[model samples]
Target: MRDYLIAFLTTGAITFVLSWIVWKVAIRYRLHPEIRERDVHKTPTPRLGGIAMFFGLVAFFLISTQLPGFAIVWEQPIRMWALLAAAALMVVVGVADDLWDLDWMIKLGAQFAAAWIVVGIGGIQILFLPFGSQVVVSSWLSISLSILAIVIVMNAVNFIDGLDGLVAGVCLIANAVFFAYSALLARDFDNSPETNTAVFITVVLLGVCAGFLPFNWNPAKMFMGDAGALLLGLMMASSAIVVTGNLPPQLLADNDQFGRSQLIGAYIPMILPIVVVLLPLLDFGLAVIRRTAKGRSPFSPDRQHMHHRMLDMGHTDRNAVFVFYAWTAVVSLSVLLMYIGTTAGWPGLYLPGLAYLLIGGVACVLVTLPPSRRAARVASDTKASS
Candidate 1:
């Protein structure tokens, strides 16, 4: 934990300094592109913040080399180095798209390529299902599914990069939850040095996101742009892959049947990662379907993203970002608590976590839609204007 804290503080310091430098350089050079009609912000903001994040990631990698308990993690250094390579590939592709708005086809190709770098070069495929006695799959199936999952998550995260601070904040919260899971896994579940690998990367992610948020907040000085968002998604997917792939067999077989419900303590490790990105995946799936139905490219840009809808439904920019934060926190924390309870063999946490999930979800839905609130505001505005 002390080592992890050092990594976090180191990453935060480096990322913060780099973000400031990048933002200033971008501003001085007027590197931002002209604003588009559908864009929310009036001024062109620098989108090169991802450059700082990439470098900060590099710093974390450097520090990781010296950290204790990493011998198990670094036994085959290729995988970790390959992860860095994949991130560099993503950052380059992302930077190009950020500057020139590269064709969606090109960006998609790079995304797949990045995933390949991780899976093929890194040799980090999802070894087996992390639950129900660790159901193993064929090698080809593992690589294919791992690559596909990486691509899906990368795009899902990128798709939600519509609001300032939205991606950074939501990811920060999501990683915070996963970081806790990994930490507990290290100290409790298996007590293997290997679990610390997940702890290491997640805290690094948490730190970078924490550092990046101040610059990314509403009325922003800069945006992480596509590169930062994609980089984030890739790391997130990779971290989950690392944890599940390396965990000891029989560690996750809490339930024989993977039932569908909120109190899914046995499946939380697998489910929580997916749930953290649930909103992004939902928005991604909906957008692809919506665009395909209209015979348009799935990556076509529009003003109808979830964040945009939140705005159209009367959420202020910060409020909308907050709503995303709220949803992420509620879902991720609920699952984390359930896992803690189940693993600790404490009083049952199923009902309590379920209650929180239901209540928080209902509140999120109300705040998200709020039809009467919108209508009343409309009426009030019309009356005031008249």
Candidate 2:
């Protein structure tokens, strides 16, 4: 307990100081993002905040390793090194894009290449299928799946960075859930092999974002730009893959001694990554669907994002951010409840998971309702204008 507390506080303080230092540097350099087409804010904001976040993550990992009980995660450290390398690649690509307006193709190519390096050279692949299922993929398939996951998550985080605090806030929530799940797995579930790595990465990620949020929130002082968003996305996705693929088989054996079905009783927390990250995934899905429907490039910038829709409906920047924050909280709490309820035998495990999906589905509708009405009024006004 004391170790965990120290880890959290040490990481948090390191992140804050690093972020503040980077914030000052950005101000000095005038490295700001412009209000371009499809932009959500009116004022230019510093775009290299990710630089601070990167340093913060590095600082946390270093600090954690020095503490007792955390040395192993840094020892060998292939996974950590791989993730850091991938993150650095993305951050460089992102920062370049921010400064010089790199085309989407180049940006995407950079992301894919970085992901490939991680999975191929670093050997971080998704070896498992669904939780507790023996249906594992071949090494080739695992590498392919890992690449696809990385790409999807990279874009999801990048796209969701449209509004102030959105990306940082969402990452914080998701990592928190993941950290708790990993900690529980480590403490209760026989201190599984995958526990330390999962906890370490996610804790570092949470610390980075914790340091970032104060500068990112509404009427923001600094933007994370593509560097931060892409780096964060990759880290989150990589951690999820690691947690789900490695933990279950070791901890939740398909034996009769436990008496509980590993399929049902275990793997409940497997849904944490998905549920906690529902908003970005949903928004990314909608963005693709809407853009494709309009005969436009999916990568093209547009004002059809969830936050944009909220703003179009007259929600303030802070309101739009908070509304999404509320939804994120709802999904997180629902997952926690489901975890507890399933353990207590309140209902089947899938029920709570399904309940979470249903709630997110419903919230999606409620949030868009105001925007729908606003759209009607906009059309009516345009007709009058013509």
Candidate 3:
């Protein structure tokens, strides 16, 4: 834990400091693009903030390799290099797309190339699903599944990067929950949690998000654009892949220590990953469906995102972003608690997690919908504008 803290602090410091430098450089050189018709913000803002995060990620990884506690992670040099290479590739592609608005096919091709590097070069492919029993997969299926997951997550994260601080805040909360879950798994399930790579990855994610959020908040000075958002998703997916490889599905399923483990434990490993990115995935699915229904490309941009809907519900931009943060926290923390409860043989925490989900969900809906009159006015205004 102590070593992980060091890693987190160093990463946060680097990202935070570098973010300021990037903001200044971008402002001085007028690096922002023209404001789009659908954009909520009136003024152009720098979108190269992800460059700082990219550097911070690289800096932290290089420094950690030299640290004693991170020795185990570096033992397999190929995986780390692959992770870095894939991330850098995404950064390059993202920067180009952000600047030139590259065609969807070109961006997608880059995404596939990066995924292949991670799977083929880094060997971070998923070997099995952590179901009740290990559902082993063939090598071809493993590589295919891993690449698809990476690409899906990358796009999902990018799709929801509309509002100021939306991606950074949601991802920050998601990584915090994942880090807790990963840390617990490393601490209890593994002999030496100190050198565990998954925990290291999660903390680094949390740190970078934390550092970047200050500049990305409402009334933003900088945006992560495609570069930062894609980079974040790729790293997160890679971490998820590697963590699943370390998990013992059988241990998670067993009722040896506790009287019960069937309800949540058997599937929590798979569930938790999906839960963390639930909001992003929801938005991505909705956009694809909505676009395809209109006979347009799924990758086409529009103002009909979940956040845009929240605006239609009469939410201020800041309030809408907060709603996203809250939903992500409620869902992620609930599952994370369940994971701890089942793993620690504490039936008490597990049961309460269900209650937490119910209550938090209700609260989220209440916060999401405006009063009857407000909703009517918002509807009227939206119709007038359309």
Candidate 4:
């Protein structure tokens, strides 16, 4: 726990400092592209924030190796190196796209290549079924599913990087939730190196996002661009793969059919990582479908994202971002509570679940409320004077 806190703070501080440096460099180099019609921000902002985040990730891993509790990660050099290599590849691709617009095919190919590096080289493949009695999968199927999962998560996060602080905030919450769960698994149930690595990855992710959020929030000083978005997506997907793929086989066995059935019925944690980002996935799928139905390429850029819709429905920039954040928190925490219920029984479920529901419900209502009545009254009075 102490090591985790140290890792988080160290990584966050490094990323925060690096973010400022990157911002200045981007401005000096005139690295930002001209604002497009579909853009939400009026002013052009410096990008390449991902460069800072990538460095932060590297720094965290290095620092972790020196920490007594985290040093065990160093034993698995291949896995660590593979993740870094894939992240570097994505960063390069993202930086290129930010500097000079690349063709869609080139970006897509790069994503696939990075996925292959993680799954094939790092050996982080999804090998279990979250549902059904069956758990283990064939090697070919595991590899294929792992790649597909990585691609989906990568693109989902990239697609939702529409608002200032939106992606960063969402990723921070999602990673923190997963980190908590991973830490629990490692500390109590599974003290394996694999679980510890997952915790480390999540900590790194949480730190980078925390460090970057200040600059990326509303009235942004800089944008993360594709570089930050893709890198974040990759890290999140990698953590999920590492945790899920490395689970002890006994956890997934059907030795006691009734007990297994009961556990499976409530054990949403197995898929909690994916569920936490379901909003982005849903938005991405809808965008593709909406574009294809209009006889346009699925990748065609547009202003019809969930955030865009919020703006269209009269949400201010900050309000829209916060609304999305609240929804994500609700979904993530709800799933987390369900997982606790699965392991700790009904009493564990009711209190936290109800509290989350009440708080989340109120937050959603408040965020979704129309423009203030006070403001409306002032507008009417001004109209009358006119």
Candidate 5:
């Protein structure tokens, strides 16, 4: 626990410092692109923020190796090296896209390459079909599924990067939830090297997002561009792959505390990468459908994103971002609580269900309220009086 905390702080601190430096360099060189019609920011903002985040991730990994508790991670050099190489590939693709506006085909190919490195070289791939089912898949199937998961998550995150602080905030919440789940598994079910790796990856990811949030928040000083967004998505996917693909079902089956049915349900926490990313996936699907119906390419840029719709509905920029944040938090925490209940039988399932109702109700009310009704009325009265 102490090592995790140290790793988190170390990574965050380094990222924060590097972000500041990168912002200065970008500003000096005028590295930001011209604002496009679909963009939210009126002014040009520097990008390449991913450079800082990548360094932060690498720094933390090195620091973790020095820590006595985390030193064992280095023993499995292939997984560590594979993850690092994949992340480096993502950073290169992202930087090129940010600077040169690389073709979508090139970016897609890079994503596939990164996914291959993770599955083929790192040896991380989904093996089990479901929790209770004894169905095991072929190596080819596992590899294909792992690559598919990585690509889906990468694009899902990229799509949701439409709003300031949106992707960072959502990823932060998701990684935190997964980190907690992994930590719990390590403490309770399995203390194996695999679980430890998951915990380490998640902790580092949480730090990366948290550190980058300040610079990427509303009225932003800089954008993460494709570099940071894709890198974040890759890390999140990698953590999920490590946790879900590596942790064997036999561990849960061996535990006498859960029945067969309950054990099946317990797989919810294990599959959190899919569950927690529900919003982004939904938005991505909607965007694809909306685009296809109009005879546009699925990757065609547009202003119909969920955040854009919020702006269209007259919500302030900050409010729109916060609304999405609240939605993500509610969904992630609800899933987490329900998973806990299923695993430990402590909190009731109704807790998360009720939380959903409460959060959704509040969000609806907030979104529907007129922005600064009192202020608008005051201005009108003042004009008349004058």
Candidate 6:
């Protein structure tokens, strides 16, 4: 408890102070995000908020390692160093894009490099396979799987950072939940060093996001831009991989009766990440499908995201961001309840969370008809000008 408090306060303070400094730099450099024809923001806004987040993460880890309660936990600092290295790479790539507007292919190549740095060099890969039988993936397969997961998570988060404070807010909540799970896992599993590392990273991430959220909220002073968003996504994904990758095999065993059903149950925790981040992944998928169908690049920007639909439904920017925030909270809380209810001897609550996903996903679809479909003539005119 004491260690968690120290981590939270330390990281939060570092992130807040650094973010303020970055905001000032953004103003000084006039690094503003322009309101394009398809943009939802009515005014230009400064970017490079990610630079501050990067500093916050670096500073927090540096300071926390020296604290009495954190010293033992920080003993194996190689993993942390690897995370920092990956973040630094992403930050540079993101900053370059924000300033110079790099092409999509170049940005993507950098993302792959960032993921590989951690998976290949950092040695953060899930080896154990629990599907009614115990197995470990080959080194090559693990490397490929880790890189793919990290890249997907990194891009999903970047793509979701469209609205004010959305990514930061969602990340804070997600990390908080992950922190709880880490602590719970730590409490449940005694023979693993990964638990402490997982908790430490998640808490630091939570603090980093908390520090950035105030600056990122509605009527924002500056955007995290690609740099902040990509770094954040990478950090979150990296933490998830570390935490679950180290789980004990017995804990992952499937509980069902059917041969295949039991196998699937064992993979639940491994699969939960994709499910947890389904919104962003689904949104990205839809965006690609929509763009490819029209012979346009998927990277093309437009006001056709989940947040944009909220805006079309008469939500102000703040309201729209908040609405999304509320949805994320509900989904997260529902999942928590389901996890608790099922584990603590009650199985009824799981349905509610699954139901919510179906309802919310359908609502998002019904409301967010593509801008091309809903306002085709207007879209054609807008594209013509662009």
TM-score of each: 0.91, 0.86, 0.93, 0.91, 0.90, 0.85
lDDT of 3: 0.86
Runs in model 6 deviating more than 4 A are: 133-135, 254-265, 347-386
- Residue range with the least summed lDDT across 10 consecutive positions in model 4: 252-261
Per-residue lDDT tens digits of candidate 3, residues 1-386? 78989988999999999999999999999999999977888889999989999999899999997899888888788989999999999999999988889999999999999999999999888877765466777899999999999999999999999899999999999988888877776666653422277778888988898889899998999999899999999988888888775455565555464226675655787788888999999999999999999999999999999988888877889999999999999999898877777667674848777888999999887787765655787789999999
Residue ranges of candidate 4 with Cα displaced over 4 Å = 252-267, 348-355, 358-366, 369-386
Which tens-of-lDDT digit does each residue in 208-253 have in candidate 2? Answer: 8887888888878888999899988888888777767655454455
Query: Candidate 3, which ten residues in sequence have the lowest lDDT sum?
Result: 186-195
RMSD of 5: 4.5
lDDT of 4 at 64: 74
Task: Assess candidate 4 and give its lDDT.
Answer: 0.84
lDDT of 6 by residue, 1-386 (tens): 78888888888898899889888877887778667676666777877889988998899888876777766566667777888999999999999988888999898899999899888888888776665554677889888988988988888888888788888987887777677766765675432556677788888888888998899887788888899989878887887787677665655453222122343435545655555566677778888888888999987776787677767766667766665666665566556544544444444435665676677756655434444454776678899999
lDDT, candidates in the order shown: 0.83, 0.76, 0.86, 0.84, 0.81, 0.75
Give per-residue CA lDDT, model 1, range 160-273, as digits (tens).
Answer: 998889999999999888988888777766655446666777888988998888999988999998889999999999888877665545555543232323235345778877
- TM-score of model 1 vs. true structure: 0.91
Question: Which candidate do you rate higher for lDDT, 4 or 6?
Answer: 4
Candidate that would win on lDDT: 3
Which candidate gets the maximum TM-score versus the true structure? Answer: 3
lDDT: the better of candidates 2 and 5: 5
Candidate 2 weakest ten by summed lDDT:
250-259
Report, for all candidates in order, the number of backbone clashes.
Answer: 0, 0, 0, 0, 0, 0
